[model samples]
Target: METPPQRNANMAQIFHRSTNFISRFSLFAGIFLAGLALTGVLGLARSPYFTRQNVTRSQPVQFSHKHHVGDDGIDCRYCHTSVETSATAGIPQTKTCMSCHSVLFNNVGYLEPIRESYRTDASIEWVKVHRLADYVYFNHSIHVSKGVGCSTCHGRVDQMPLMFQANTLLMQWCLDCHRNTEMALRPLDKVYDMAWRPAANQAEIGRQYKAERNIRNTSELSSCSTCHR
Candidate 1:
Protein backbone atom coordinates (compact mmCIF):
# COMPACT_ATOMS: atom_id res chain seq x y z
CA MET A 1 0.00 0.00 0.00
CA GLU A 2 2.95 2.39 0.46
CA THR A 3 4.46 4.37 -2.43
CA PRO A 4 7.63 2.75 -4.02
CA PRO A 5 9.75 5.91 -3.39
CA GLN A 6 8.70 5.98 0.28
CA ARG A 7 9.40 2.25 0.66
CA ASN A 8 12.90 2.58 -0.79
CA ALA A 9 13.65 5.59 1.43
CA ASN A 10 12.45 3.68 4.51
CA MET A 11 14.63 0.70 3.60
CA ALA A 12 17.71 2.90 3.12
CA GLN A 13 17.14 4.62 6.49
CA ILE A 14 16.75 1.26 8.27
CA PHE A 15 19.91 -0.11 6.75
CA HIS A 16 21.92 3.01 7.64
CA ARG A 17 20.70 2.92 11.25
CA SER A 18 21.51 -0.77 11.60
CA THR A 19 25.03 -0.30 10.21
CA ASN A 20 25.78 2.62 12.61
CA PHE A 21 24.55 0.67 15.66
CA ILE A 22 26.66 -2.35 14.77
CA SER A 23 29.75 -0.19 14.13
CA ARG A 24 29.45 1.63 17.47
CA PHE A 25 28.85 -1.64 19.40
CA SER A 26 31.86 -3.27 17.85
CA LEU A 27 34.14 -0.29 18.60
CA PHE A 28 33.05 -0.13 22.24
CA ALA A 29 33.59 -3.87 22.75
CA GLY A 30 37.03 -3.80 21.16
CA ILE A 31 38.12 -0.87 23.35
CA PHE A 32 36.82 -2.49 26.52
CA LEU A 33 38.66 -5.79 25.89
CA ALA A 34 41.88 -3.99 25.01
CA GLY A 35 41.70 -1.92 28.18
CA LEU A 36 41.12 -5.06 30.29
CA ALA A 37 44.06 -6.84 28.69
CA LEU A 38 46.35 -3.81 29.18
CA THR A 39 45.34 -3.57 32.83
CA GLY A 40 46.21 -7.23 33.45
CA VAL A 41 49.60 -6.76 31.80
CA LEU A 42 50.38 -3.59 33.74
CA GLY A 43 49.44 -5.26 37.02
CA LEU A 44 51.75 -8.17 36.25
CA ALA A 45 54.61 -5.82 35.34
CA ARG A 46 54.27 -3.79 38.59
CA SER A 47 54.84 -6.75 40.90
CA PRO A 48 58.23 -7.38 42.55
CA TYR A 49 57.98 -10.97 41.37
CA PHE A 50 55.74 -12.57 38.78
CA THR A 51 52.95 -14.87 39.89
CA ARG A 52 53.97 -18.45 40.56
CA GLN A 53 53.37 -20.56 37.48
CA ASN A 54 50.56 -23.06 37.79
CA VAL A 55 52.48 -26.29 37.53
CA THR A 56 52.97 -29.47 39.54
CA ARG A 57 55.14 -32.54 39.03
CA SER A 58 54.83 -35.82 40.86
CA GLN A 59 57.66 -38.31 40.52
CA PRO A 60 58.43 -41.87 41.51
CA VAL A 61 59.37 -42.48 45.23
CA GLN A 62 57.55 -39.21 45.93
CA PHE A 63 61.03 -37.68 46.12
CA SER A 64 60.66 -34.53 48.11
CA HIS A 65 62.99 -31.64 47.27
CA LYS A 66 61.50 -29.78 50.24
CA HIS A 67 62.31 -32.57 52.65
CA HIS A 68 65.84 -33.00 51.32
CA VAL A 69 66.68 -29.40 50.46
CA GLY A 70 64.65 -27.65 53.14
CA ASP A 71 63.97 -29.86 56.15
CA ASP A 72 67.13 -32.02 56.19
CA GLY A 73 69.21 -29.07 54.97
CA ILE A 74 70.86 -31.16 52.29
CA ASP A 75 72.41 -28.95 49.65
CA CYS A 76 71.42 -29.50 46.01
CA ARG A 77 75.08 -30.10 45.14
CA TYR A 78 75.06 -33.19 47.35
CA CYS A 79 72.57 -35.09 45.17
CA HIS A 80 73.39 -33.17 42.00
CA THR A 81 76.93 -32.77 43.32
CA SER A 82 78.61 -33.11 39.96
CA VAL A 83 76.79 -30.04 38.61
CA GLU A 84 79.19 -27.50 40.06
CA THR A 85 82.13 -29.67 39.07
CA SER A 86 81.01 -31.31 35.83
CA ALA A 87 79.48 -30.56 32.46
CA THR A 88 76.28 -32.22 33.54
CA ALA A 89 74.88 -32.75 36.99
CA GLY A 90 74.19 -36.29 35.95
CA ILE A 91 71.21 -38.10 37.42
CA PRO A 92 72.05 -39.79 40.69
CA GLN A 93 72.82 -43.44 40.06
CA THR A 94 70.95 -46.29 41.73
CA LYS A 95 73.84 -46.53 44.16
CA THR A 96 73.27 -42.93 45.14
CA CYS A 97 69.64 -43.63 45.97
CA MET A 98 70.57 -46.94 47.59
CA SER A 99 73.08 -45.18 49.81
CA CYS A 100 70.33 -43.11 51.36
CA HIS A 101 67.78 -45.92 51.13
CA SER A 102 70.14 -48.35 52.81
CA VAL A 103 70.28 -45.96 55.73
CA LEU A 104 66.66 -44.73 55.69
CA PHE A 105 64.64 -47.14 53.54
CA ASN A 106 63.71 -49.10 56.62
CA ASN A 107 61.79 -46.15 58.01
CA VAL A 108 58.27 -47.58 57.69
CA GLY A 109 56.64 -44.46 56.41
CA TYR A 110 59.32 -43.34 53.97
CA LEU A 111 60.89 -46.24 52.15
CA GLU A 112 58.04 -48.71 51.48
CA PRO A 113 57.74 -47.96 47.77
CA ILE A 114 61.45 -47.23 47.43
CA ARG A 115 62.29 -50.64 48.88
CA GLU A 116 59.75 -52.22 46.55
CA SER A 117 61.54 -50.71 43.56
CA TYR A 118 64.91 -51.89 44.89
CA ARG A 119 63.55 -55.38 45.41
CA THR A 120 62.40 -55.51 41.83
CA ASP A 121 65.87 -54.34 40.71
CA ALA A 122 64.18 -51.72 38.62
CA SER A 123 65.20 -48.11 38.63
CA ILE A 124 62.53 -45.64 39.60
CA GLU A 125 61.45 -44.03 36.33
CA TRP A 126 62.01 -40.45 37.39
CA VAL A 127 59.65 -38.14 35.56
CA LYS A 128 62.01 -35.55 34.21
CA VAL A 129 59.97 -32.35 33.88
CA HIS A 130 62.71 -30.09 32.58
CA ARG A 131 64.44 -31.08 29.40
CA LEU A 132 66.00 -29.61 26.26
CA ALA A 133 67.03 -31.08 22.94
CA ASP A 134 70.16 -33.22 22.83
CA TYR A 135 71.94 -30.68 20.62
CA VAL A 136 71.72 -27.89 23.23
CA TYR A 137 74.68 -28.03 25.57
CA PHE A 138 74.39 -26.77 29.16
CA ASN A 139 77.20 -26.93 31.66
CA HIS A 140 76.50 -26.78 35.34
CA SER A 141 80.11 -26.00 36.11
CA ILE A 142 80.23 -23.05 33.71
CA HIS A 143 77.21 -21.48 35.38
CA VAL A 144 78.53 -22.38 38.81
CA SER A 145 81.91 -20.91 37.87
CA LYS A 146 80.12 -17.71 36.99
CA GLY A 147 78.66 -17.83 40.52
CA VAL A 148 75.18 -18.78 39.40
CA GLY A 149 73.46 -20.81 42.11
CA CYS A 150 71.42 -24.00 41.85
CA SER A 151 68.15 -22.18 42.45
CA THR A 152 68.58 -19.66 39.62
CA CYS A 153 68.00 -22.36 37.04
CA HIS A 154 65.93 -24.70 39.19
CA GLY A 155 63.50 -22.10 40.60
CA ARG A 156 62.27 -22.21 44.24
CA VAL A 157 63.07 -25.87 44.58
CA ASP A 158 62.91 -25.82 48.34
CA GLN A 159 59.19 -25.22 47.97
CA MET A 160 58.53 -28.13 45.63
CA PRO A 161 57.46 -31.45 47.12
CA LEU A 162 58.43 -33.10 43.87
CA MET A 163 61.18 -31.91 41.53
CA PHE A 164 59.87 -30.54 38.24
CA GLN A 165 61.75 -28.54 35.66
CA ALA A 166 60.51 -25.18 36.89
CA ASN A 167 61.98 -22.94 34.24
CA THR A 168 61.23 -22.96 30.51
CA LEU A 169 65.02 -23.60 30.05
CA LEU A 170 64.80 -22.56 26.43
CA MET A 171 68.00 -21.48 24.68
CA GLN A 172 66.80 -17.89 24.93
CA TRP A 173 66.25 -18.35 28.67
CA CYS A 174 69.75 -19.71 29.02
CA LEU A 175 71.21 -16.83 27.00
CA ASP A 176 69.29 -14.23 29.01
CA CYS A 177 70.69 -15.39 32.37
CA HIS A 178 74.11 -16.17 30.96
CA ARG A 179 74.46 -12.78 29.25
CA ASN A 180 73.48 -10.63 32.26
CA THR A 181 76.74 -9.98 34.08
CA GLU A 182 74.72 -8.06 36.63
CA MET A 183 72.69 -11.23 37.22
CA ALA A 184 74.86 -14.28 36.43
CA LEU A 185 78.20 -12.81 37.57
CA ARG A 186 77.71 -12.59 41.35
CA PRO A 187 79.56 -13.09 44.65
CA LEU A 188 80.52 -16.35 46.37
CA ASP A 189 77.65 -15.49 48.68
CA LYS A 190 75.46 -15.37 45.61
CA VAL A 191 76.50 -18.88 44.66
CA TYR A 192 74.94 -20.41 47.79
CA ASP A 193 71.90 -18.27 48.48
CA MET A 194 68.86 -20.28 47.36
CA ALA A 195 66.79 -17.32 48.55
CA TRP A 196 68.91 -14.43 47.30
CA ARG A 197 67.16 -11.06 47.17
CA PRO A 198 69.62 -8.63 45.43
CA ALA A 199 72.63 -6.33 45.95
CA ALA A 200 74.43 -3.51 44.13
CA ASN A 201 77.96 -4.90 44.77
CA GLN A 202 77.02 -8.44 43.72
CA ALA A 203 78.84 -8.40 40.37
CA GLU A 204 82.10 -7.00 41.77
CA ILE A 205 82.09 -9.50 44.61
CA GLY A 206 81.40 -12.32 42.14
CA ARG A 207 84.18 -11.21 39.81
CA GLN A 208 86.66 -10.95 42.70
CA TYR A 209 86.19 -14.62 43.61
CA LYS A 210 86.76 -16.21 40.21
CA ALA A 211 87.36 -19.60 41.70
CA GLU A 212 90.96 -20.72 41.30
CA ARG A 213 89.36 -24.12 41.82
CA ASN A 214 90.40 -25.06 38.32
CA ILE A 215 87.67 -27.00 36.59
CA ARG A 216 90.01 -29.87 35.86
CA ASN A 217 90.14 -30.43 32.08
CA THR A 218 88.41 -33.67 32.97
CA SER A 219 85.62 -33.28 30.38
CA GLU A 220 83.56 -31.25 32.84
CA LEU A 221 81.65 -28.41 31.21
CA SER A 222 83.39 -29.33 27.98
CA SER A 223 81.67 -30.13 24.71
CA CYS A 224 81.30 -33.55 22.94
CA SER A 225 84.86 -34.39 23.85
CA THR A 226 83.52 -34.89 27.37
CA CYS A 227 80.66 -37.23 26.46
CA HIS A 228 81.97 -38.91 23.30
CA ARG A 229 85.63 -39.85 22.58
Candidate 2:
Protein backbone atom coordinates (compact mmCIF):
# COMPACT_ATOMS: atom_id res chain seq x y z
CA MET A 1 0.00 0.00 0.00
CA GLU A 2 1.19 3.61 -0.70
CA THR A 3 2.48 5.44 2.33
CA PRO A 4 0.48 8.36 3.63
CA PRO A 5 1.34 11.75 1.98
CA GLN A 6 4.34 13.36 3.65
CA ARG A 7 3.67 16.46 5.78
CA ASN A 8 6.08 18.60 3.63
CA ALA A 9 4.29 17.63 0.35
CA ASN A 10 0.88 18.48 1.85
CA MET A 11 2.05 21.89 3.18
CA ALA A 12 0.51 24.80 1.23
CA GLN A 13 2.64 27.66 -0.27
CA ILE A 14 2.57 30.83 1.93
CA PHE A 15 3.99 33.26 -0.74
CA HIS A 16 3.35 33.59 -4.50
CA ARG A 17 5.92 34.37 -7.27
CA SER A 18 4.39 37.87 -7.59
CA THR A 19 5.35 38.52 -3.98
CA ASN A 20 9.01 38.54 -5.03
CA PHE A 21 8.35 41.30 -7.58
CA ILE A 22 6.36 43.35 -5.01
CA SER A 23 9.13 43.11 -2.45
CA ARG A 24 11.77 44.16 -4.97
CA PHE A 25 9.66 47.09 -6.18
CA SER A 26 9.08 48.29 -2.63
CA LEU A 27 12.81 48.24 -1.86
CA PHE A 28 13.78 50.13 -5.06
CA ALA A 29 11.01 52.66 -4.62
CA GLY A 30 12.11 53.44 -1.07
CA ILE A 31 15.70 53.90 -2.23
CA PHE A 32 14.65 56.17 -5.11
CA LEU A 33 12.46 58.29 -2.85
CA ALA A 34 15.23 58.65 -0.29
CA GLY A 35 17.73 59.75 -2.94
CA LEU A 36 15.27 62.26 -4.38
CA ALA A 37 14.62 63.75 -0.96
CA LEU A 38 18.34 64.17 -0.31
CA THR A 39 18.84 65.94 -3.64
CA GLY A 40 15.97 68.35 -2.95
CA VAL A 41 17.40 69.28 0.44
CA LEU A 42 20.82 70.05 -1.04
CA GLY A 43 19.26 72.14 -3.80
CA LEU A 44 17.27 74.16 -1.30
CA ALA A 45 20.38 74.83 0.77
CA ARG A 46 22.15 76.41 -2.22
CA SER A 47 19.13 78.29 -3.53
CA PRO A 48 18.86 82.08 -3.68
CA TYR A 49 16.37 82.06 -0.81
CA PHE A 50 18.96 80.52 1.47
CA THR A 51 22.02 82.33 0.08
CA ARG A 52 20.23 85.74 -0.14
CA GLN A 53 22.00 86.50 -3.40
CA ASN A 54 20.69 89.54 -5.26
CA VAL A 55 18.09 90.24 -2.56
CA THR A 56 18.12 93.86 -1.39
CA ARG A 57 17.72 94.52 2.32
CA SER A 58 16.40 97.59 4.09
CA GLN A 59 18.91 99.49 6.21
CA PRO A 60 18.38 101.94 9.06
CA VAL A 61 19.26 104.64 6.55
CA GLN A 62 18.58 103.99 2.90
CA PHE A 63 22.08 104.60 1.54
CA SER A 64 22.21 104.46 -2.22
CA HIS A 65 25.41 103.01 -3.66
CA LYS A 66 24.26 103.97 -7.14
CA HIS A 67 24.03 107.63 -6.22
CA HIS A 68 27.20 107.68 -4.14
CA VAL A 69 29.55 105.58 -6.25
CA GLY A 70 28.04 105.90 -9.72
CA ASP A 71 26.71 109.44 -9.82
CA ASP A 72 28.86 111.12 -7.19
CA GLY A 73 32.07 109.20 -8.04
CA ILE A 74 32.66 108.27 -4.43
CA ASP A 75 35.35 105.68 -3.88
CA CYS A 76 34.74 102.49 -1.85
CA ARG A 77 37.63 103.27 0.46
CA TYR A 78 35.85 106.44 1.54
CA CYS A 79 33.43 104.25 3.45
CA HIS A 80 35.16 100.88 3.94
CA THR A 81 38.40 102.33 5.26
CA SER A 82 40.28 99.22 6.37
CA VAL A 83 39.66 97.00 3.33
CA GLU A 84 43.20 97.28 2.08
CA THR A 85 45.05 96.66 5.36
CA SER A 86 42.73 94.78 7.68
CA ALA A 87 40.88 91.47 7.82
CA THR A 88 37.61 93.34 8.42
CA ALA A 89 36.38 96.13 6.17
CA GLY A 90 35.68 98.82 8.71
CA ILE A 91 32.25 100.35 8.41
CA PRO A 92 32.18 104.07 7.70
CA GLN A 93 31.87 106.07 10.90
CA THR A 94 29.26 108.77 11.27
CA LYS A 95 32.12 111.27 10.92
CA THR A 96 32.90 109.91 7.48
CA CYS A 97 29.38 110.71 6.38
CA MET A 98 29.39 114.08 8.14
CA SER A 99 32.57 114.95 6.21
CA CYS A 100 30.49 115.17 3.06
CA HIS A 101 26.86 115.45 4.18
CA SER A 102 27.76 118.35 6.46
CA VAL A 103 28.30 120.23 3.18
CA LEU A 104 26.11 118.30 0.71
CA PHE A 105 22.53 117.38 1.55
CA ASN A 106 23.13 118.36 5.16
CA ASN A 107 19.53 119.33 5.79
CA VAL A 108 17.89 116.38 4.05
CA GLY A 109 15.17 114.70 6.11
CA TYR A 110 16.36 111.22 5.20
CA LEU A 111 19.83 111.99 6.54
CA GLU A 112 18.49 113.00 9.95
CA PRO A 113 19.72 109.68 11.30
CA ILE A 114 23.27 110.54 10.29
CA ARG A 115 23.20 113.90 12.05
CA GLU A 116 21.61 112.31 15.09
CA SER A 117 24.25 109.59 15.17
CA TYR A 118 27.00 112.18 15.05
CA ARG A 119 25.42 114.32 17.75
CA THR A 120 24.65 111.40 20.03
CA ASP A 121 28.07 109.81 19.42
CA ALA A 122 26.28 106.57 18.64
CA SER A 123 27.15 104.32 15.69
CA ILE A 124 24.64 103.81 12.91
CA GLU A 125 23.38 100.25 13.14
CA TRP A 126 23.88 99.61 9.45
CA VAL A 127 22.78 96.19 8.28
CA LYS A 128 25.57 94.12 6.82
CA VAL A 129 24.84 92.75 3.33
CA HIS A 130 27.51 90.23 2.48
CA ARG A 131 27.76 88.05 5.55
CA LEU A 132 29.68 84.81 6.00
CA ALA A 133 29.52 82.12 8.61
CA ASP A 134 31.41 82.80 11.83
CA TYR A 135 33.30 79.55 11.41
CA VAL A 136 34.80 80.81 8.15
CA TYR A 137 37.62 83.35 8.26
CA PHE A 138 37.96 85.76 5.39
CA ASN A 139 40.65 88.44 5.02
CA HIS A 140 39.82 91.42 2.80
CA SER A 141 43.42 92.63 2.72
CA ILE A 142 44.76 89.26 1.61
CA HIS A 143 42.36 89.04 -1.32
CA VAL A 144 42.92 92.71 -2.21
CA SER A 145 46.66 92.18 -2.15
CA LYS A 146 46.25 89.12 -4.41
CA GLY A 147 44.91 91.36 -7.20
CA VAL A 148 41.29 90.32 -6.72
CA GLY A 149 39.07 93.27 -7.50
CA CYS A 150 36.24 94.69 -5.41
CA SER A 151 33.79 93.99 -8.18
CA THR A 152 35.03 90.42 -8.46
CA CYS A 153 33.13 89.41 -5.33
CA HIS A 154 30.98 92.49 -4.59
CA GLY A 155 29.74 92.75 -8.19
CA ARG A 156 28.86 96.06 -9.91
CA VAL A 157 28.17 98.13 -6.86
CA ASP A 158 28.36 101.33 -8.91
CA GLN A 159 25.22 100.25 -10.75
CA MET A 160 23.36 98.92 -7.70
CA PRO A 161 20.62 101.19 -6.34
CA LEU A 162 20.76 99.15 -3.15
CA MET A 163 23.62 96.99 -2.04
CA PHE A 164 22.92 93.25 -2.31
CA GLN A 165 24.92 90.09 -2.52
CA ALA A 166 25.87 89.43 -6.13
CA ASN A 167 27.09 85.88 -5.70
CA THR A 168 26.31 82.72 -3.70
CA LEU A 169 29.55 83.15 -1.72
CA LEU A 170 29.49 79.42 -1.06
CA MET A 171 32.52 77.28 -0.36
CA GLN A 172 32.30 75.73 -3.82
CA TRP A 173 32.11 79.19 -5.44
CA CYS A 174 35.29 80.15 -3.60
CA LEU A 175 36.93 76.88 -4.60
CA ASP A 176 36.19 77.47 -8.28
CA CYS A 177 38.18 80.70 -8.16
CA HIS A 178 40.90 79.16 -6.03
CA ARG A 179 41.37 76.20 -8.38
CA ASN A 180 41.84 78.49 -11.41
CA THR A 181 42.72 81.84 -9.88
CA GLU A 182 44.40 83.16 -12.99
CA MET A 183 41.01 83.95 -14.52
CA ALA A 184 39.99 86.22 -11.61
CA LEU A 185 43.21 88.20 -11.19
CA ARG A 186 43.07 91.80 -12.44
CA PRO A 187 45.54 94.65 -12.54
CA LEU A 188 46.09 96.00 -9.04
CA ASP A 189 45.21 99.49 -10.29
CA LYS A 190 41.84 98.22 -11.53
CA VAL A 191 40.97 96.55 -8.25
CA TYR A 192 38.39 99.20 -7.44
CA ASP A 193 37.18 99.80 -11.00
CA MET A 194 33.52 98.84 -11.19
CA ALA A 195 33.52 98.79 -14.98
CA TRP A 196 36.65 96.67 -15.21
CA ARG A 197 36.31 93.98 -17.85
CA PRO A 198 38.52 91.08 -18.80
CA ALA A 199 40.65 92.05 -21.78
CA ALA A 200 40.95 89.74 -24.77
CA ASN A 201 44.37 88.74 -23.49
CA GLN A 202 43.25 88.58 -19.89
CA ALA A 203 44.21 84.94 -19.58
CA GLU A 204 47.80 85.78 -20.49
CA ILE A 205 47.86 88.82 -18.20
CA GLY A 206 46.35 86.85 -15.33
CA ARG A 207 48.94 84.09 -15.63
CA GLN A 208 51.70 86.67 -15.51
CA TYR A 209 50.25 88.40 -12.46
CA LYS A 210 49.63 85.11 -10.67
CA ALA A 211 53.27 84.18 -11.11
CA GLU A 212 54.54 87.61 -10.14
CA ARG A 213 52.32 87.85 -7.09
CA ASN A 214 53.36 84.38 -5.91
CA ILE A 215 49.81 83.22 -5.30
CA ARG A 216 49.51 79.82 -3.73
CA ASN A 217 48.74 76.74 -5.81
CA THR A 218 45.27 75.21 -6.12
CA SER A 219 46.05 72.48 -3.60
CA GLU A 220 47.05 75.06 -1.02
CA LEU A 221 44.14 77.43 -1.54
CA SER A 222 41.59 74.59 -1.50
CA SER A 223 42.96 73.25 1.76
CA CYS A 224 40.63 73.36 4.80
CA SER A 225 42.80 75.76 6.77
CA THR A 226 43.00 78.33 3.96
CA CYS A 227 39.46 79.61 4.53
CA HIS A 228 38.50 78.01 7.84
CA ARG A 229 41.39 79.41 9.82
List the RMSD of every prediction in angstroms.
7.6, 2.8
Model 2 Cα lDDT, one tens digit per residue, 102-195: 9999998999999999999988898888999999999999999889999999999999998999999999999999998988999899898999
Badly placed stretches (over 4 Å) of model 2 are 1-21
How many backbone clashes does every candidate have? 2, 0
Relative to the unseen true structure, what is the C-alpha lDDT of residue 204 in candidate 1, on a scale of 0 to 100?
A: 59
TM-score of 2: 0.90
Candidate-wise lDDT, in order:
0.65, 0.92
**Global CA lDDT of candidate 2, please?**
0.92
TM-score of candidate 1 to 2 decimals: 0.61
Residue 1 in candidate 2, Cα distance off native in Å: 22
lDDT of 1 by residue, 69-173 (tens): 778887776778687778888777666676777877567765666677778877777776666568665677877776677777787788888766666654446
Q: What TM-score against the true fold does each predicted structure earn?
A: 0.61, 0.90
